[model samples]
Target: MNFDAFITCAVTGSGQSHKKSDKVPVTPKQIAEACIEAAKEGAAIAHIHVRDPETGAPARDVALYKEVVDRVRSSDTDVILNLTAGMGGDLILGNVESPLPLGNGTDMAGATERVAHVEELLPEICTLDCGTMNFAEADYVMTNTPGMLRAMAARIRDCGVKPEVEVFDTGHLWLCKELVDEGLILNDPVLVQLCMGIPYGAPNDPNSLMAMVNNIPKDWVFSMFTIGRMQLPYVAQAVLTGGNVRVGLEDNIWLEKGVKASNGDLVARANTILSAMNVNILTPAEVRAKLNLKKRG
Candidate 1:
């Protein structure tokens, strides 16, 4: 079991979570404040995704990212920043009868265009989804082809940022190893996030989680998380299985059945869980040292 683990607070995800929980941050100021609050509550890293302040829709505006990053950096709170590079690859196909025209939600872009924010802001870490898969929606698919992943990984490396390889299934883990073998992932100990319980990804069952874990390279670092009601429980499961933990409004909104949760609440709860298990929660600086991460502006 992992005696020491770090919690990554996914402050705001690029989803319609704001509609479900008023506590989910939408505007740049609110998002940054959420990150700081999570840090104060013992989260070592804040995983961020910006949105349209007016509409509460997911957005890829570089200006918005700059505002959020600048606000967090200027704050007294110290937390590692991890931006989402998983935004621009969304794909919603046209109706099944006639699939010639792409759907309105299709937002595919070139590799460089996808990581524009990573190039400019240069966060300490960014996410690289390892493979394409049919996401939750009926017609939607998360498209991250091998070619696109390689290109994006190369660019993120050039920016001196660590790419947190996000693996949704066993195949994605294989692709992650291939990237490591090809020398695209340059970090001394490659970092990975096992995203379990997504609709079409790896199931959250212990066996499935173990399948993903067993395939990981011995030297790599990984964190595990699941969505919805299982989020809190997985905190213990993750540590017991020799992995770190992740929790925040991004993955799960409700703290309990009839209650809503804030980012700080989630981080604090994870901290309590970890502390109870005699697992030490690593600080942001400690996580940097463990992952061999380079902190930049």
Candidate 2:
């Protein structure tokens, strides 16, 4: 088992989570506060996603991101920031009969437009989803074409911000390897997030997670996260399989049954779980050094 692990807390996600739990941070102030809280609870990094403050829906607005960044950077708490570049790829299709007219939730955009915040804010790290996949049980899809991946990966590499390539399946891992081979993902200990349990993608089963973990490059520094109920379990599984862990409202919102959790609560629980397993959870500075990450000014 890998005794040293670092936790990444995905502060808020681009999902319909706001509808389910009121604890999901929405406004920039709330998001930044959540990041700080998670860091105080022992998370080394904060994986972030901006949302419409008014409607509590996922958004790709650079201004919103800037506000969140400024707040976090200006704070006393220390945590590596990891903004999500996974937006602008939501494809909501129409009814089975009328597929031509895309649904209203579709927010597709070009590669450059997608990473606008990353280029401007220059967070310590940003995510580059490695492949396209059906998002959930609905008609929604998280579309990340190979060509798009190449472009985004190149941009993030040029920005000098570590690209946390998110791999939801085995094919995504293959594409991540290709990016590393092409020199787009420049970090030596190449970083990846095994985003398991998102429907129509990889399941949150031990066998499937091990398959993905085994395929990861022997040298790559990877983390694993699963959605809903499987989120907490992956913390143990990831550590045992020599991987880092991620938690927060983005993936799961409960500390225990009938108990809604905040970003801090989730990270603390993961911390507790790792500690019990005799795993030394690395701090943000340690994570930076391990991943060769340079924090933005």
Q: Best-fitting candidate, measured by TM-score? A: 1
Per-candidate local distance difference test: 0.93, 0.90
176 Cα displacement, candidate 1 (Å): 0.5
What value does the lDDT take at residue 137 in candidate 1? Answer: 85
lDDT string for model 2 (230-252, tens) is 88988998988999999999988
Error of 2 at 145 (Å): 1.0
Report the lDDT tens digits of candidate 1 across residue range 175-281.
Answer: 99889889999748999999999989999999999999999888989998999999999999999999999999999998989999999999999999999999999
Please report how far candidate 1 places residue 233 from its true position, in Å.
0.2
lDDT for 65 (candidate 1): 96
> lDDT, candidate 1, residue 80?
96
- TM-score between model 1 and native: 0.99
